[model samples]
Target chain A: MEIKKTSLNKLHQSNNAKFVEFAGYEMPIQYSKGIIEEHKFTRSHSGIFDVSHMGQLFIYGDESLTEELEKIFPLDLKNLKQNCSKYSFLMNEDAGIYDDLIITKIEEGYLIILNAACKDKDFEILSNLLGSKFKMNLDNNRSLIAIQGPKSVEILNSIINGVDQLNFMTGNWFNSDNQKLFVTRSGYTGEDGFEISITNDKAEKFVENLIEKGAKLIGLGARDTLRLEAGLCLYGHELDINKTPVEANLRWAISKSRLSNGGFIGSKKIMNQMQDGASQIRVGIKPEGRLIAREKTKIFNDTDKQIGEITSGTFGPSVNGPIAMGYVDKEFSKVDTKILLEVRGKKHPANVCALPFYKKNYVKGVN
Target chain B: MSEVKFSKEHEWITLEGDVATIGITKHATEMLGDIVFAELPEKGSNVEKDGTAGVVESTKAASDVYTPVSGEVVDTNQAIVDDPSKINEDPEGAAWFFKLKMKDQSEMDSLMNKEEYDKFAKESAS
Candidate 1:
């Protein structure tokens, strides 16, 4: 498959970024500073990431759009306030998760951001389900950039005003030199950050401006570690068509109203799992030693019985240890449960622990 | 004078009389990024030329460390295992992975010397 390039490709090359193929795009995995340096910098300072590859879809329709969307997803759009963002799941009939997305309710319609690799599939699903009910507009002329970390607000606030006061999970338009920039005070990294959507024509200059203001250019390498440390689930890893939200430990995204309302797709199976407790549950795993157990590493029980497998694993720089997230039988999924990881034909000891291997440092309301 | 030698897989070996110190080349560390974990072969283990002796893991992936020549492991550097970052700090010197006693002295002729290995490293990168 031919790989696509973002508008900031030239800028990344000029900045000495190491390129890697990701989601059909040749993206920078890291710069000269390397992943560890970039990861640490983002924790203490600020970092800018070119997330243009993500799919941005705008849904427009009449008053019935919300009800129609709620029927297709396990989301509670009724209480979703205007200009607020909510994380939701796109589920199939089997109660399995098809994709995960962030939906922002606007005045006229809704803006949804999804994973890049799942963009075409998501659009096709939306069209097939609600083709006559809503108009789906895929925004390709815009680029998305995320400025994240502790100093993100200070760095970005220096260029655009009032962004420092934007609460987490809130989306609004800010005018900059007559350009209406849609920004959300949220990010994948467990930090105080903002994701800005700008036109392709102005993306290069905007990124250059952020770098000039001390936002170091980070790549996908550090981005993975940051999100992993935040305990955020990547679509293909922590979520899959065969896995339900309740099994992935993402029940928080489903509100109480939706569970009781019981009209969404796969609501029956989802509620059943929630009530009876999922057969398997996702939990954090910390390996006993320095050997990092990567994805697909099998997990074993006390009697050496294979119980589960790791879905996502990496060396978390902030945590200063190897951490992983995987699904295990609900009976063995508990804090401080001893588990064995089969790595390279050897059984290494590990323990199930609380997630978010590192503490989240989000800038919520009044924080 | 004893001199440094290089293998096709980017490992480096330096012979000082009967003992040979082995470590990865500077180019290898740069390509691997930050070194997070390292597993070295145990002392007194018999290994063959181009055989996997240890493993070095970076944040991105893990790579096997191959022995440049057949030998018996005399001493293993536990420092790199205790703190893998040392390999990134000084891959050719203080971070030498292991020391071995060469089984056959004739094997040294097959390895590339300083001048030849420099050109080889540069060519392989391109």
Candidate 2:
């Protein structure tokens, strides 16, 4: 298969980015300043991420569309306000996550942001479930760019104008450069940021403008470190076909009203796990000293019984230490629980800790 | 002290009497960016030629550091283990990994020199 490239491929190369193959696309791993510098830069200043490879799915429908989607997702679409967003999961009958996404209610219908690797399959599955009743376009002509950090609002609001008024988890369409762009105050990094949906042809120029406004381009390497420090989940690593939202400790995302009625696709299994609890649950693991227990590294009990495995682990530049997230037995998932991580054929001591290793600075409300 | 020799594994070694000091080359550090963790072989342990003696981990991944020649481990740098970023800052100087007492002095014969390793490093990277 031919490797794919995003609209900003030339820009990344010109900035001396080191490339890596991610989800079949040749994406930049890190730029000239490297991961640590980029990660820190995003925390202190604004950093731009070229997330164009992700899926921007627009589904247009009427009143009946909301009714039908409520049966598929566990969200209360009837009560959800326009231009507001919610973090959700597309699941199977067994409650296993197909992909985790952010769905925003727009003026016409809903726009869903999906993981790049699973977008095609998600489109097929949704098309089958909806049975052609609505119009769905998995847009390839659009590009997604995320600008994140402490100074993101000031930097972005300068160009787009009126963007600083947006509260977290909300979005609105604005006219910029003679085009309509859907700008949302949300991002993967646990910083104040915005994700902008713009036409592919204008992406490079848009990013260059952001650079002129003091935002720097960051790569996937720093993105991983930043998100890991924030305790966010990645699709292939923290979420998969075998993992359910309940086991992943994301039960809060499921709407309370939907839990009682139990009409959604995975409601039965979800309710069961909610009541009886899951066998394994996700938790934050902090290794003692500088030992890094990477993905698939085994978690063990004091007596050497294998209990779980690490899903994501890395050196968090903000925290200046090694951090990891993994599934441990539900009995051992409590904060401050002592656990062991097996790295390079040796067991190292670690502790189960509360998530968000670095505190989030989200702008929740202005009024 | 003598002229430093390099191994294909990107480690540099300098022999003084029978004690040979070794550390990963600067080229190796450039390849592995932002090192965060390190582990050294135990002192008094005998290591075989080209065997794993230590480990270094960057934010991206972990790599096993290899010994170019067989010897008994005499000293290890605790400073690098305490602060691995020094490996990125000065890998060739203050970040020397370990010192080994030679099991066979002639074991250094086949290793690459500075000019040879430069060419090898360039070819291997491409």
Best by TM-score: 2
TM-score versus the correct structure, for each prediction: 0.98, 0.99
Interface Cα RMSD per model, in Å? Answer: 0.7, 0.5
Reference-based lDDT, each prediction: 0.91, 0.95
Clashing pairs in 1: none
Across residues B25-72, which tens digit of lDDT does each residue of candidate 1 receive?
Answer: 999999899999999888999999989999998899889999989999
Off-target runs (Cα >4 Å) in candidate 2 are: none
Assess the local accuracy of residue A139 in candidate 1 as a C-alpha lDDT between 0 and 100.
Answer: 92
What is the Cα-based TM-score of model 2? 0.99
Candidate 2, residue B22: lDDT: 95
* Candidate that scores best on DockQ: 2
Fnat by candidate, in order: 0.83, 0.83
* Predicted structure 2: lDDT: 0.95
